[model samples]
Target: MLRYIAFTVFLLVTGAAGADRLETSAGSVAVTQVVGGLDTPWAIGLLPGGAFLVSERDGNLLYVADGTVNRVKGAPKVSAAGQGGLLDVTVARDFTRSREIFLTFSKKQKGGAGTAVAVVRLSENGKRLTNLRVIFEVTPGGSGGRHFGSRVVEALDGTLFVTIGDRGDRPAAQDLQNHMGTVIRINRDGTIPGDNPFVRDQAARPEIWSYGHRNPQGAGLDSQGRLWVSEHGARGGDEVNLVHAGANYGWPVISYGTHYSGQKIGEGTSKPGMEQPEHYWDPSIAPSGLLVYSGKLWPQWKGDLFVGSLKFNYIARLAGTPLREVEQIKGPETERVRDIVEAADGSIWFISVGQGAVYRMTPDT
Candidate 1:
């Protein structure tokens, strides 16, 4: 059994299962395995009663508590193929009383598939969900299974924001008529937010908050409640952008990276109307999860941004207005870090896809 040391001191113990003790500029850090035997867990939501809700890519929502993983029933049927399947899960702030959970998944449509969102009520015992319903779904589902930019975040005012990819159709990102390659906003019941960017634009999807995003997977609200996202670019040019309503992020039009065929993208990374990324990675770490650290155990890390590196296998520590990678935390437990979350207690939790386990990071003692 792994022992829990007091948080006030610094001590490193090794040889524990799923625990990797490392030293960093902040101080000693320890990552311990909380639960394992998951099948490609994509995202996690913190539950009120000390349990975690984890979504697996194979179309299963798992309830993990007391070191045991239980499969949650009543999730929407998903198209679990090629970067699709069950994705992000977010719990409502008043979860204890509301029992409402939001989910984003790759839903199969008539001839193709698209990213879809659903709202469901988790049972009191945490066994299943009832009253399942789709709150939002991307329009004009297209063929192929790539680039489902599915991530869900609840804004401070309880509005919902979801990301949808271009579905391998690069040019579609620039089109506002369909839901592809856009960030959309809606009410809790899936109604279009009146303040959404394109709500008045009859030619555009009214739910679109912003457009021209490529395969965005990581999204989170900062300490100030500002929404930010990390998206993947071709060959290179991964980006982190501060999302704004009515904004147009240059995707295919102005990219720092070349196409997979080594062709130049757009008119070269600069245009009058397109918004620039807050930070970008040239070689592409393939960012997946994002969290703005509200540090509790490590007070020094508060306000810093924590991002997962899927390609390089590490957690990136970014700082500054135009974010820059200051540190990369990687060790035995660092594996295809897929999703990241900061618990109410301020402990850091992440889904390590490489290890098929959910790992927790805390101050060493």
Candidate 2:
């Protein structure tokens, strides 16, 4: 049976609660609210000089600083329909010097059929995207508007890790050659990484890094240099994965969730060669954006993994252990969380996917 999720209203209306100690297998500490009241904010990017950039799914880019916000100019026009819009925005790794930004979005294509992923550079002056480009794109064959799983991350090696959705095609998830249902790795200049798994394969897109994902909306790097991804399963199998080169995640083939009619998904939960998730949620937390926090403000949370939820509307603090829940934080907008990032001052910032709100969580002053 299909489940229904309710969205919380604008986040600015909420008040901060006193800090409380957290308990986790990895470790935990106090959590305090810093600021709130954002409008369907979808993603956050921390600038070098203690400034912040926030994206609203409805196509507005916001600049938040000191205790206020200002709208940026020239946001790309987007579809903003069912699960589509000005999606993700991120600061370039060299932002301290270059003052450039990169992001992904689902914009309307020529036909009413598909959506394309655009990666544009945000000017430092917050005026317009100077060097706009569609670095990599997916097949725009949307049937009923679901699953673009588009999240962008700059790898330590200067490669871009991009997550693509299964495009509402179940069986295609197992197809080795398609761009859908795969994590793609590309150079910052939009070229396929030479060392990618499919780079030399004539049958596969050279950019394909890993395969068999439903919609991995969240990705981040931990202290150990491991790349972690959070994804939504068919109905119940929300997963957290440690990404490995050339691994297949086994989406439609095996899942913690059953079919719409309560039938089996595929062969089974475990199969040969397919890499299983490091952790998964059976009841479906609808995990969205992910961040491995390293800020000093929350020294207790330094090196811990923080994930946002769409259905649960909480920022879940998970233990580094294989598969177990550690802490669930419900203070943000209580809406579908779209992205989370560490601020310049070591604070944690996040955005709401529907209400277009941005929030900050910091240690007790």
Best by TM-score: 1
Q: Residue-wise lDDT of candidate 1 within 1-365, one digit each (tens)?
A: 12112210111222134457978778888888777666788999998768889898978887866545557889999998889999999998878888999999999998789999999999877889999989889889978989998889999999998989899998899999999889999999999878787888889999999999988999999988899999999989999999999899988899989998998998898899999999999999999999999978788888888899899999999997667999998886778999999998898999899987788888888
Candidate 2 per-residue lDDT, tens place, 182-250, comes to 888888878877788877889877888898999898999887777889999866788998899999999
**Positional deviation of residue 347's Cα in model 2 after best superposition, in angstroms:** 1.6
Residue 172 accuracy (lDDT) in model 2: 78
The TM-score that candidate 2 achieves is 0.86
- Candidate 1 worst ten-residue window by lDDT: 1-10
Off by over 4 Å in 2: 1-38, 66-68, 110-119, 332-335, 353-356
Model 2 lDDT-worst window of ten:
1-10
Indicate the residue-level lDDT of 65 in model 2.
53
Clashes of each: 0, 12
